[model samples]
Target: MNATAALHLIQAPVALCLDDEINIDLSATDPDGDELVYELTTPLHGANDIDPTAITPPPFTTIVWETGYSETYPIDSEPLFK
Candidate 1:
């Protein structure tokens, strides 16, 4: 059988303050009742080309964010996103 994991009852604040701390919940369930483990890692850069005729094929390459910008702090925000 294929591995299947699903998330339910996700919680998030409707509003976030600029001066706030990081909080997260990764609770999830598997129909097969397999134990779940969550870890944070940099995501892969699937495609970066603009208006390309074709998308790149695997093996996909890693990407880096510009200075002061990242997958988290992608845009300018009050007090910064970090």
Candidate 2:
């Protein structure tokens, strides 16, 4: 799927605090194809809930940390294959 399509798959809250983590789920299928793979592209900085590589700023001292969670699963499809 394209970038626009990928964005649609992710459902993040509009108003999130600095420490809040967003969760997104992406699931796709190809009607006439097989071996579909789901790709989740996020900003390198915003991707990790608490990036150890990130240098905390002074203002971050008062901010609380939150974890973002997401999950994806095959909904309904034809010709169920194991």
Candidate 3:
């Protein structure tokens, strides 16, 4: 279980009303030839929802893990709050 896998965002400015999809790419060859599996240890939120005091913005961390694995990316919607 390595934690060096880099996570990226495919889309930005995710909306608060709609659910978003995120991709996690984890294609790598280990020296010991270990099969790699990607799992989200923690929740990733959009820039808007990060700060709670910002007038209750829409949900920004709804990640739907797809099949397969290398670089983890996120699909963001439009911003609900200002």
Top lDDT: which candidate number? Answer: 1
Which stretches of candidate 3 lie above 4 Å from their native place?
1-25, 44-82
Cα error, candidate 3, residue 74 (Å): 6.8
lDDT of all predictions, in order shown? 0.69, 0.42, 0.46
User: After superposing candidate 2, which stretches have Cα over 4 Å from the reference?
Assistant: 1-10, 38-82
* Tens-digit lDDT string for candidate 2 (27-82): 66555555666553332332245675667554433322234422222222233311
Best by TM-score: 1
Residues 1-82 of candidate 1: C-alpha lDDT, one tens digit per residue: 8578988776788888886664556677898889888654556676446754557689977677779766666667566645
Clashing pairs in 1: none
Q: What TM-score against the true fold does each predicted structure earn?
A: 0.47, 0.28, 0.23
Q: Model 1 lDDT vs. the true structure?
A: 0.69
Question: On residues 6-82, what C-alpha lDDT tens digit does candidate 3 reach at each position?
Answer: 33434444453446544344355555555667564435544355676554366656444565421343333344211
Clashing pairs in 2: none
Q: For model 1, where is the 10-residue window of minimal lDDT?
A: 39-48
